[model samples]
Target: MGGYVRATPMAVQADEGVPPSTSLPDIGAASFGAGDVTVETVHLPDDRVQITNTAAYPWRVHCSLHVTAADNSEWIGTGWFIGPHTLITAGHVVCIKHSGVPGRDGWVRSIRVMPGRNGATLPYGSVTSTNFWSVKGWFESGDQNYDYGAIIIPTELGSNTGWFGFGNWSDAELLSTVGNISGYPGDKPAGTQWYAARGISSVNALKVHYDIDTAGGQSGSAVYRVLNGNRYGFAVHAYGGATTNSGTRITRQVYDNFVAWKA
Candidate 1:
């Protein structure tokens, strides 16, 4: 018999550097899942160290964020892949809050995700997406405690690059663990990635506070801990406070949501 080939459905990906639409036809605030500044909440003597070699594992997993809000206002934040095509960030990153104008207060217009991006250099390239998701607590009320969300890209960009495993940890476990945060900070050069690690300062039902240095654009960065050589996320970085920055803890409910969204 002559050689034959069976066609298999393959994931179609845009060419490297194919940027997302600069302006999505106004979707209006109602038709969205929605909704920063480029201010990191870093403490005095910023301890964040830049990751110049963004092509490596873990570091490469970090992404620089550029969001176009529903009101067409632009901001910067950070996000990380947790699944083949899913990236998690602050709920505010997906849905703008207050914005002073209620009419422009829902989901963001679009986002351009650059994984493992180095300053002026895209080691892993970039993709623009309009798909986003957030919980009712945030989507409806814009609660800071509920400020965490996911961005789904059409391509499986994480397959080759890999992702982080997120889980719910007890207060005891979290308090005893040192959390890690790495992302693009506004205080640093545009597109460059930075990192910090510190013992978790506090943990509550809704938030995990840490002394890890982070600036404005670092929101949505994973607050993860390494266990036996594996990295597992315990929270979703969200707010910066005067004493300590914090994240939305990955409670059972949030973990369930993440699993559901990834599926």
Candidate 2:
């Protein structure tokens, strides 16, 4: 697969790049049910109370992306900080996908990232992107396997909430580990955030499947694992399947690109 990059509206001057750090707070290992366990799912009845607080997930950011080709269309998705200025998301959230054809002429006009956005609340303020990026396989062929993207912001948002670490893990680690997903769902009030935690049900080279209840705007949500007191995002949530929702798995290339972007 090939790679591609897109430009967004210019960002206001902000801090210089924050060097990547290895100092992550150890959140400890997540627990799961024993013996042939079946995961139970719960949708947040009140997004404000459940996920609005910065303490809940300081790294979670709500994205407002504008596409010009779709009649100045505005879409809501989710993303998280991987570095002081780099945010990761799904490529479809940034590019326009055409059915049965290569991607049409849709490009991101602008993008706003609100860190820890609760209903009508912006705890850390909002930042706009200076640039956008994605794999060529998705923009060129609408390949779901490469449905991931990143946004470059001006501020050091990670300094306030910290950021998620990225790694390539085996299917065994995914299936056995408890995962958490948090994002803004379109079904809920605008800017509202919700979350769900469940054990991964399946995994592949390109995706990780879970029973996590997510809605339309939740695409680009972070599918992360809490380990040794630290959280690392393993996938970028994209497709919501019938019985499961899947995210683009973090492969070696994905990890390398992310690291390079941070630098």
Candidate 3:
């Protein structure tokens, strides 16, 4: 609870200081229900973002992204289209302090949505969120599982152009089944372009943990799966209290609120 703060929007100054780097021990992989998810391995340099995928079955979906404060700043994140122009991501990614100010000119630099792996440059379209929200409990409790946020994408994504719809929230019974997940880990310098992990839990809770690997830059990555023969995004990366090498659970929370916003 040392680094805990309310998940509320506050003005921020440009971050002129170099981003600090911390290395945590890698945990081991986890096993799950059969044939539901398949992970694709990806490697990265010692100093890049890390990520893993698990949604085994393929249902076509696109990723949502935003620009970094510094040009070429290696800030990367993961997101999926929920509606025509609306994409969902961890609010922290799209919203950052400009410098170190508490409530100043913090703004989203840029945002983009890509259709497949290896398409970071080609933003299906970019937009900003008019409003953002997070659970008060998540902020006060310091539980990574409850961390959530949404973006109110621009006109371009809403008009049958670049957006994708969301999937219904499956019960704990459904999440206990198998599923695959994907995301772009900005920390990874190479290996596979998109970090993919397989066989993750689909349960709904404040802390639905998984064995999928990820790192700091992957904070906003998506956790999804193929249910009922359709691919749908259901969650986003909040934080990791454990590691893949240590058999740690990649903590996440379902995007129920965002889905409700779309409906």
Q: Which candidate is the best by TM-score?
A: 1
- The lDDT values for all models are 0.77, 0.65, 0.41
How far out, in Å, is residue 213 in model 2?
0.7
Question: How do all models score by TM-score?
Answer: 0.85, 0.79, 0.56
lDDT of 2 by residue, 169-254 (tens): 99888889987888766656666667777889899888888877876666677898888898889998877655776888998888
Model 2 misses residue 49 by how many Å? 8.0
Candidate 1 least-lDDT 10 residues: 1-10
Model 1, 1-263: lDDT tens digits are 11111112234334445433232222112222233321247788888888887898988788887777666766777889999899998887877766666566767777778999887677778877777888878877766778788888878888867899999989999999999999887667777788999999999899998889987677789999999998989998877768888999999889988888788
Give the Å shift of residue 189 in candidate 1.
0.6
Give the candidate order by descending TM-score.
1, 2, 3
Q: lDDT by residue for model 3 over 221-258, one digit each (tens)?
A: 55666567655555565455422211112232233455
What stretches of model 2 exceed 4 Å from their correct place? Answer: 2-4, 8-49, 55-70, 99-104
For model 3, where is the 10-residue window of minimal lDDT? Answer: 24-33
For model 1, name the residue pairs that clash: 34-107, 35-94, 35-95, 35-96, 35-107, 39-215, 39-216, 40-215, 40-216, 91-148
Task: Find the candidate with the highest lDDT and give its number.
Answer: 1
